[model samples]
Target: METSAQGITPPAAVYEIAGRRFEVGARGFADAVAEAHAAHQRPRCMCLVVGVEMYVARLGGGYIVKRMPGTGSHHAPDCPSYEPPAEFSGLGQVLGSAIIEDPAAGETTLKLDFPLTKMPGRSTIPPTGSEGDSVSSTGTRLSLRGLLHYLWDQAELTRWHPGFAGKRTWATVRRHLLHAAEHKIARGEALLARLYVPEPFSIEERDAINSRRLAQWQSAVPSPGKPQQLMLLICEVKEIVPARYGCKAIVKHIPDQAFAIDERLYRRLGRRFEAELALWGASDDVHMVMIATFGVCSAGLPAIHELSLMPVTAQWLPIKNSFEHQLVGQLVADRRSFIKGIRYHLQGGRGLATAVLTDSGDAVMPMFIGLAEEGKLPKAEAVANAVGMGAAAAWIWRPGVGPMPPFPPMQRARSLIRCA
Candidate 1:
């Protein structure tokens, strides 16, 4: 059972994880995971490699790949194959040879050098009127833009295969792709099949939900067979406040500060939560949320200040702690195919647009942006106040609503270099 901040308890429920079952009381599992993940220090085996053309797929709702047995490509039939839907043509083809290295893991790392297009690069899609909104990109490099959408919608591990808690690591799955590609490219390597991630989320619906629209974008529109001229920016959010039960107004009042509860005991605590949970994947969700939020911003900053109480009726599978559940969301605009500033946010660091809301009514902001980094808000009451009218802004916590002050609203007045 879930409990409201005011003491109204929902109902008790039992959930199974890795064959062991546990009971959840009103508080749920948010705090426990927060504490465990906070203390977790095993170095991760995954790393990011740009510029590789590897095959990826959502088979039977899970991510699966075929790779060479010993990472060699010379052995024929020895070279195994993993096939995705014919429609899943471009996963990630552009970028150039970039190594996804976990230097600590030695050869477990992969170098992805996806081929760029020989076709002339095209600028922004020509204005095709309202119909233009439906046009997809055409080229060889999978749209990093679309790939972001694919990666975010993946919920196979948590929602379906409960035991495989750590299966979603993008780097692990990328290695599987590298293996598959190696086998397909050469003869010595045999294509061996392995499940990348078990179960795919309802991407079409989740996307619609994230976008906050009734129309299904990925399903309704056929993927443009060619890749367009596009660039990708990898971002990492440093902190995230697990969603806690509280009044909308009260929850809004919570501050974004993440100081260690015991600084003296935990001398190594980083300045942010993502820094703290770098291995557990809190940052990826933050990035995806930001993408949806930018979609909301493009739609003119609708009434997004309402608190979200996602219903938790099942055995609450805890993503953060015994008290928290992983909540994924997105925003979209009813009109237009593109948004502004997200590319900037993806580039990272030092910009007034720390947060971006999408045209579809979603909003994205780093889980934490120190008050010192924020630009000064207008002192005038009408502009300075964080909420209601002209005070348009997106802070993890609304200023003055709870105990903390809101960060400055994003502004597009200046151009700046990214910090990534």
Candidate 2:
């Protein structure tokens, strides 16, 4: 009680995050203030630590006290030891390991922010010739500042223990970023043409990113044979920046079969895409595509690559008539069906992060999502609804022939059985 700030209410002093809260007591107030201040000072370096036992719980008119070692002790020169209650579970161990087990422990609990932001739903890619002769025909360049801003834009990292304000720990930021980059990289060749901006993402970070990306691409052993019923479409969206002339995008296409080999092929296949619009014509927008498989080809080799022949569309499954009438229930439960599919594919542990260049001079960001992996097409649409995403352009690339983009998927939803 000695450390408690006089007149400060318990409700006002405590804050919650990710299902946990920071509880400061009269005796623990001073230490909490010092810890929070120190962590805030080096926002980038701050790693969160929680003390499970310091909390008190009430149940059915009963009171329970949770206290661990070093509750009232001074900062020790040695690490403190405490056992978590059974109900406290896994997070207890995660937080405990992250705690600073120092010989001089100034605080009993430490809490850091989410550290980095989540990937933005949108991003921009620079187009060729936009630099107005500043860049060579064969040159490939990336913007360092733009990449930093993208990393900063992630909304998820706002709650991080210390905000990114003045905290310039590139090493910690990069470490956290690489973890996220792993998800994109694991998608394989379908994503190989897209560029990824991992934090602490300096030129130095390229090697690590490339190595991980390649490793992930090589690991994806495509599903044996073709999928029955609905088809699979892998899309990578890139923000476009127009060059001196205008904006142009290469919507390269990849077959489901190519996913078995290194997805890097998708990147190589970029040359096959084509555009008739004058360069720099569309510089004010971001360009992306949804490449999917269509009808069989003459060679019967899955056509290898093709574009624009057919438009993209979605079909829903049969559901009980009673459930169909419940619009709110469908909206509430079916949301995020698509994003969940992308997440499932991402978690499957294989795929590439494609790096695409825009003909537009403006900047672009790429997002990769899968349509077939999230159970079925209907669920994927649900996910798209949850995230406010719509139909995307299609990419199909081949030698001599450039990328041919198909029309965006129809926005309206259709049912498996005709609506009675």
Candidate 3:
């Protein structure tokens, strides 16, 4: 929530911050964010953070610029970013640690602990050992699962309450993800440019959507004998029913369209993400999210090149078990603002907390779900240290150990951060 009162850089034409008018070029926006200047800074209408702050967002036309949302700063109780109490959630374990931001570069570096792309053509067997130990890091790159988690969190899709139940839909998820991706630049390209979240295919809009798809996929086509470029798709899986020659992934949005996964690729998915597939089969409450790199064939059919799977709650929140469901159910009822910690590489609650609550200041709350049978606490000291949250407070809940912790009091209305 820190912001500076200064001029901005490129990727922006003109902007107003705290009633001050300033103008810059295309690279101005990025330079301002990177240098911690004042490009996208706007006065806070909510939250306790002092001064105007910068945020990644899109503006008029197609320009990616910084925006300040009155409800997104996490400072005020009524803001969408506001939470119960930092001590009640595990937000402290990540903020300045695992998740990072670079405004100038328009990128957010996420430290993930799961593998995204396996060695080309390598065996797809699940690596032996506990799931908690599977930390994937060759650099700052995030695994497919990690990327999806980050996106979900960034989209604010993880913040849910019972009141939002049934109100959330694929259209809503797509809208938020697209907005979150607005000013984000990943690997030298706009994140939104590389993403594909299919729109609801309708008989009326079929021709228009198809024409757009044709234009997009045509760029991926290569010269004779040249390899085609890969495209990224984030879609909810409907069914893995059999097709003419292999398996077809029926997408929830594009019900009329299917992505082909050849026999080999299908086997790879089953072998590598057996747990995800199994979880998807176990309940209708959880759904599978797939992030796959695909290429269009000469016949215009899309085929998978590399892919990964993840299970998310019906609310699109990432969840792994009934235990999390119970915890989330209560949190939702209490209207808490918390982010679920994903076990990408780590398994069995071996690292990080169950969830983290975010607040205005630096302190974040890390919550853990302790097991009574095991009679043990989660090994989260190293996790806290890893995320630079060693000094942050924490909360642990042991089932059959009485009721959960009470929600924190709301911020006084008098403390509102009035925006000019």
Candidate 4:
């Protein structure tokens, strides 16, 4: 077994394929995996004693192992495929109900509260607040922002490690987003078919890229008698500026095209995401990520219906404020492995862990950053409730109190023993 720097053995990336154990780097491992994929065999990850089942996915003519749906928490914490318990974030509020996973079929069915097809003569109601604040009446349908968070989580974009610094570019983000959309079904339509992530721009092949984009958007073009199909767009915001008639949103990598936003929707966006906009504007290193549903008009113009904005650090980890920004930066500097928590439909005042450190000791540590306003810090009860959910130990930083306390010390990697 390979040992880590601390002299403890980390969980081996081993799997049982067709009743045989194969380590990731062993000879003929690739051939064994390919054969298993061809034979329609499910591989079991040996991260735990009993091992958790995994599936093989084909990507770019290569195959990759993926965890079974809803089984992420079953693996050892240090396992590469390990995901925190759903209860750790907003995912717990909707998983298995709003989001249904079919392990046998390898698909996820999403029940969305928003409309995917709009009538020609009807106007969509302007959103009163951010998508994360919109609650479903039955508490079983996912809001637009909830969908975004789900995709981001599945893409592992919420995960951070010091090794990823300076390596997360638009191309990487887009690739992961598209991959996450695979096998996702929303509104009886494949999510991949209705999703648009801009490809990296190159002056040399600009025309080809534009052609591909236009082709992909053809399905969303307005039809005279049929309901207009709307496509979901995820991109980094370059700017939102005044257009000839109303306003337009310019996204990175799609400089030639802009998504039109009417004055009312623009105002709503400003009101809904004021904090995100402010946080993004305050730092040059920050990036504004936008997820919106839009449709192509008969005149070939793309108009947005509903949208939301999230601010991420330079490393692409989501942050709600300067305090989170500071905490994430410190974690990266210390070479920590952590998962960034996302608030789906949770209210702004509700306390949630900023990030959960996975490499700390025997149990995961949830880190909280308290915001102070008018000499008042976040409520003690709210923070306690957030911590009471699962974690035993938590690290909190109240900017109003003093400097951030020292983080929990990292523990040596432990070996995962397989059961006989």
> Candidate 1, residues 1-420: lDDT per residue as tens digits?
111222211112222222223243325333332332344312110111111122222233232321222221111100112111111112222212111312122222222122222122322221222110112233222232333322321221112122223454544433433333322211112111211111122445555443432121122122245432111112222333322321111111112212111222122122222322343343333221111100111122111111101111122111221112221121111111111111100212322221222111112122222234344322223222321213333434323344443323322212111111
TM-score of 2: 0.20
Write down the lDDT of every candidate, Cα atoms only: 0.23, 0.23, 0.56, 0.78
TM-score for each predicted model, relative to the true structure: 0.20, 0.20, 0.68, 0.88
2 or 4, greater by lDDT? 4
Q: Which 10-residue window of candidate 1 scores lowest in summed lDDT? A: 304-313
For 293-370, candidate 3 gives per-residue lDDT tens digits of 676667778766666677787778876656676777666555555667664434354434677654313444567777
Whole-model lDDT, candidate 1?
0.23
Model 4 gets an lDDT of 0.78
Residues 325-392 of candidate 4 have per-residue lDDT tens digits of 88888887777878898877666565567888767644567776766553223344444354332334
Model 1 residue runs over 4 Å out of place are 1-146, 149-197, 200-345, 352-368, 374-403, 406-420
For every candidate, C-alpha RMSD to the true structure in Å = 25.9, 23.4, 8.6, 4.2
- Report the error of model 4 at residue 65, Å: 2.7
Query: Where does candidate 4 clash, by residue pair?
Result: none
Per-prediction backbone clash count: 78, 77, 31, 0
A best-first ranking of the candidates according to their lDDT comes to 4, 3, 2, 1
**Candidate 4 wrongly placed segments (more than 4 Å):** 1-12, 25-27, 34-41, 57-63, 130-138, 371-392, 418-420
Off by over 4 Å in 2: 1-155, 158-163, 166-200, 219-420
